[model samples]
Target: MSEGVKWTVLGDDDYLEIANNGRKPVKASLRIAGDIPYYGANNVQDYVEGFTHDGEFVLIAEDGTKSVDNYSIQYAVGKFWANNHVHVIRGKSELNTKYLFYYLQTVSFIPFLSGGGRAKLTKGKLVEIPIAFPPIETQNTIVSILDSFEELSTELSTELLNRGKQNEYYRDLLLTFPEESIEV
Candidate 1:
């Protein structure tokens, strides 16, 4: 947080709405295969039919995260099915959902997690996370900066992949002997 700047603390519960009611995990054997992404504590565990939610929301791992320092956090949009392992939430009122999504990436979930084998972020602990988000204007500016970086990274990666393919094509062309000059 920059000095003299206003930041919203997590203690203010009204800033966000914890919408975990839609979380319901089905057994793998009973799952109906489809195009909808089925979300777990980490990532998409599977693609199945029937969506549990149909809006923009943030998902934090409820349990099964191997490392507390690198707990799973995802920004999901549109239709999706979430299991019991993830806590679903969204910004309320004037808060920007994407802004919170970006701010959470910089947060360390270690203090909020519990459990022995698998780290768990309970609803109580989740709300207790010591996070301070900047005001909406600053948050939107930060989001814009991060999004630009992400877009540029994607472009560089695609260019590198295309360059590799081009190199392989030229390498083969340079190494091969002409068929017309080869003796049978």
Candidate 2:
């Protein structure tokens, strides 16, 4: 609700570039695939031959895991593989990938998720989630501010750990006693 900006559904064709398809059945993939890798055959790719997606994407868990307020979100760049359990989405020209990643953190998936035994965020419902479409410059600015804060937080944590180690060393040095023997 700002000047030069309007609200739009995420799945709107004008701004859509989502990828939650191309995954093959695990049994079918096994017949054509090879070399499961050293990390074991747990990767979503193991069930399929080759990669399903390439380039930047904001991956959101589709099933099997959930919390009341949030779900797992991962930002992936370059080539990667995914199964039905994750939804790989990205922006085309109008949207920015990093901006979406940041924005999704504030979204609540509980409203859109379905299923009784296992929660799932289906593709049909995901496209309907409303998103803010501020100016491109604003999106970039927000990302920059957030990134700077993250970097500073990491630096402060490291400094605190170093100071704790120094405190322990000084305490030990001050407590050291001169070498002496005592008779009982």
* Candidate 1 vs. true structure, TM-score: 0.83
Full-model lDDT, candidate 2: 0.71
TM of each candidate vs. truth? 0.83, 0.74
- State which candidate has the highest TM-score: 1
Off by over 4 Å in 1: 1-11, 172-184
Which lDDT value does model 2 have at 169?
Answer: 99
| TM value for model 2 | 0.74
The Cα error of candidate 1 at residue 67, in Å, is: 3.9
Q: Tens digits of per-residue lDDT for model 2 on 1-184?
A: 5567657877886876777665433444354554321111122334334566668888777776646466777777766566667777887687778888898889888899898877778889989899886787788888899889989999999999999999999999988866774344
